[model samples]
Target: MSGLPAYSLPCQSERATLVSALLLLLSWLATPALAQDLGTNGPTYAIAEPHLLRDLQHRLQAKQASGELDTLMARSRERAIASVRDPQPIEGVAATRTPRTFYYDPTFTLDRNVLDAQGQLLFAAGTRLNPLDVVSLSSHLLFFDGRDSRQRDQARRLIAHYEGRVKPILVAGAYLDLMQAWRRPVYFDQHGRLTRQFGVTQVPALVSQDGARLRIDELETTQ
Candidate 1:
């Protein structure tokens, strides 16, 4: 219910579009000679701490060794407030198998068939989901509106926090009724019996209920 954070640039701008552009320029200006000294990725720099250019420059200086940037910092965490870790080589660890569970959002992507053989994804648009099959993960979700300074800061922290534990899936959704307002097509339509059965009425709803407790759910805001 609170306002989403305002992004510093136009909403049309990429999440790190500005930074990417800068990197491209820097890469060009310091190519070949510096690039070799810096490694294949070059001496990387990332916004850090305060999430601003100045802060990033400060961190870069502190992190740089002489005229050479730190190898680790330059490659993975460069210019990113967060550091991306290389996957640890598993020594003798064996993979374990688990039962496949369905994770779905009508507004999001689902693998293979989101619908069952019965042709129901959840319920017909007008129908309400049964209480048994859904688990609300909204409390665990974060939103980035890019309007509020606080949310912008939070977004940075959130991105860093989930750096590699889970890959982030970015998609846009709208209230089912306002699907047309989206710049692109909505992911799914709840017009069938299944959608009706779930009684879905909102856009951007994420339902992760179990078989016994299906229901429409909204993500809790993490601003």
Candidate 2:
């Protein structure tokens, strides 16, 4: 009653479900003008909605109870190669050993594209790589969340393991804050698309892809 209005409160277990349902109702009840505003203004407008506020509060409680935003990220790595007969061939020596790395930040707003101030574009997702050409990406790195100790450690270890074989790892997890939290787009999105692709339901998952196949590796938390 003190924190929230005394209404028909559901059990804690039902928070996400309830929140989801409330959102649906809110959408159904929303005026065309309000819906248009939502499309233009994005989530900022949605936050002020009565039902959205309540749903957000419930979601906060759920997040706290569930521990940190403990979810696995999509980890994928691949090498670029050239071939005559077998285009995008999966069989190669360096390709089998070396993995292409990415240094990404969903929050990063470049004056231009993902490229640096010097004017170089970042590697596009799903870029093709060859085994012998792995050295080309040696100066590049991958960006991932590093806020949690568990996640940081796992990411660090992965980078170290791949160092020399790759560039110095860039940890972007430390930069996560409330404003950018929602904007924090992981390799996966909500509703479990890429999350399912990588089977990521926990923190510290690694993803690697060969020209022919994809592989995901998760870190084990230490007790």
Candidate 3:
């Protein structure tokens, strides 16, 4: 009060408040411009609609007219037959046997339930499955790269050998349509689940249950 200019404390507080209000107003005014810039810079996307039936019919007609379908079917049949013939004993590079004692936990709550194709309840929610409850449902899986003719042939032979005795699954193969054309009732591993679960890194590998353990055998194609 003695040396400084005479200023009211309330007046200074009002000035500070006014400055803060102005800054807030300026920030609010800039928000719309910032949003417009982002909108202009962002990517745009469009939905795609495909005519599957029309395309399939066109392809079928073209193949039928060109006589390629018959040729493909014949080649596929020959390959299927070749796979089963001249069964060469698999030459093993290594054999691994591991215990298959894995347990399954219910991932869903009681409110969630599993249904069948006909909307029938397959399993109620909160249903837990033990290791013994799923032992009989285990399947023998066959792993192969499918690009190699030798491996395909070996896989086919193995399928033929275990026909009716085991369910054969194809891993890392060519198109499923091509396999179906061969008239083999084999299933393809679309997601690489079996390969990843079993740590299979080699082609022409066979996985079968040995007592309470899984026996994984990696085989080589003989020249």
By lDDT, who's the top model here? 3
Encode model 3's per-residue lDDT on 8-106: one tens digit a residue: 566887677445444443443456653334444567778586696564556555765787655655665687775553222223312223323332232
State every prediction's TM-score relative to the real structure. Answer: 0.18, 0.26, 0.39
Q: Which prediction has more favorable lDDT, 1 or 2?
A: 2
Backbone atom clashes (below 3 Å) for every candidate: 49, 17, 0
Model 1: per-residue Cα lDDT at residue 149: 42
Q: For candidate 1, what is the lDDT?
A: 0.37
TM-score of 3: 0.39
The candidate, 2 or 3, that scores higher on TM-score is 3
Judged by lDDT against the true structure, how good is candidate 3? 0.56
From the highest lDDT down, the ranking of the candidates is 3, 2, 1
Q: List the residue pairs that clash in candidate 3.
A: none
Candidate 2 TM-score, true structure as reference: 0.26
